[model samples]
Target: MKVLAVSSIGGHWIQLLRLMPAFEDVTVEFMSTKQSFSTMVDGKKFYSIPDGNRWNKYGLVKCFFAILKVVETSKPDIIITTGAAPGLIALFIGKLFSIKTIWVDSIANCEQISMSGKIATKVADVVYTQWGHLEDNKVKFFGNVLG
Candidate 1:
């Protein structure tokens, strides 16, 4: 199966890389923002979508189109992501394309729910929470530290 793992740079990027071993036998594609951390992902099938901040409207448009192109070309069987802006876009596109999606909320939101988690929980096919106590009918408690 082909899986596209998406996440932002920094901590989220680190977590997503941990999922590499799980997809070793399958085709894996990665998408993330440009950063020094991406250097660690050498020798992998990957694409870097320009990071979008709230203020960069032009950049956001460009990145959105870039993301669409990647998803269309890759046609991943499944999409998994950790909370970040790009992940939200991937989740929406994946669902629209009938691709299976797994959205894992950030571990930092241990007590109160995060905005990303809230959005993903409403849309993702499978929603995972790092904290067991945050479990709900629509969420699966996968314990902390997914990556």
Candidate 2:
């Protein structure tokens, strides 16, 4: 199966990388806010999307289009993310394309699911939370990626 793994930079990227092991048997491509992150993936296909948050409407629009283009070109069977904004955008785009989507909320949100994650729960086929306490009917606790 072809998979597009996406996230923003920093902790989200790190958490996404930790899930690489699960993609070992499948074809996986990486996408993030920073192009420099391509190097960390060791020559695998990589895409860079604009980084945005709820505060930056313009940037979010750019990110949405960029992710839409990537989804169209990559044509991945599944799209997964450890999200901030870019990942959330990808998930929405993936759903539009009828691609399976998975969202792994950042481990940093120990207290509650991030806002993006809450939104993702509606689109993603499966939404995973690092904190067991955060699990509900919509969100699932699938163990911590960092650990």
Most accurate candidate by TM-score: 2
lDDT of 2 at 103: 97
Whole-model lDDT values for every prediction: 0.83, 0.93
lDDT of 2 by residue, 1-147 (tens): 999999999999999999999998999999999999999999699998888998999999999999999899889999999998899899989989999999999999999999999999889999999999999999999799999
lDDT measured at residue 17 in model 2 versus the true structure, 0 to 100: 94
RMSD of model 2, in Å? Answer: 0.8
- The deviation in Å at residue 125 for candidate 2 is 0.7
Worst 10 residues of 2 by lDDT: 43-52
lDDT score at residue 86, model 2, on the 0-100 scale: 90
Question: Pairing residues by index, what is the TM-score of model 2?
Answer: 0.97
Q: What is the lDDT of residue 54 in candidate 2?
A: 85
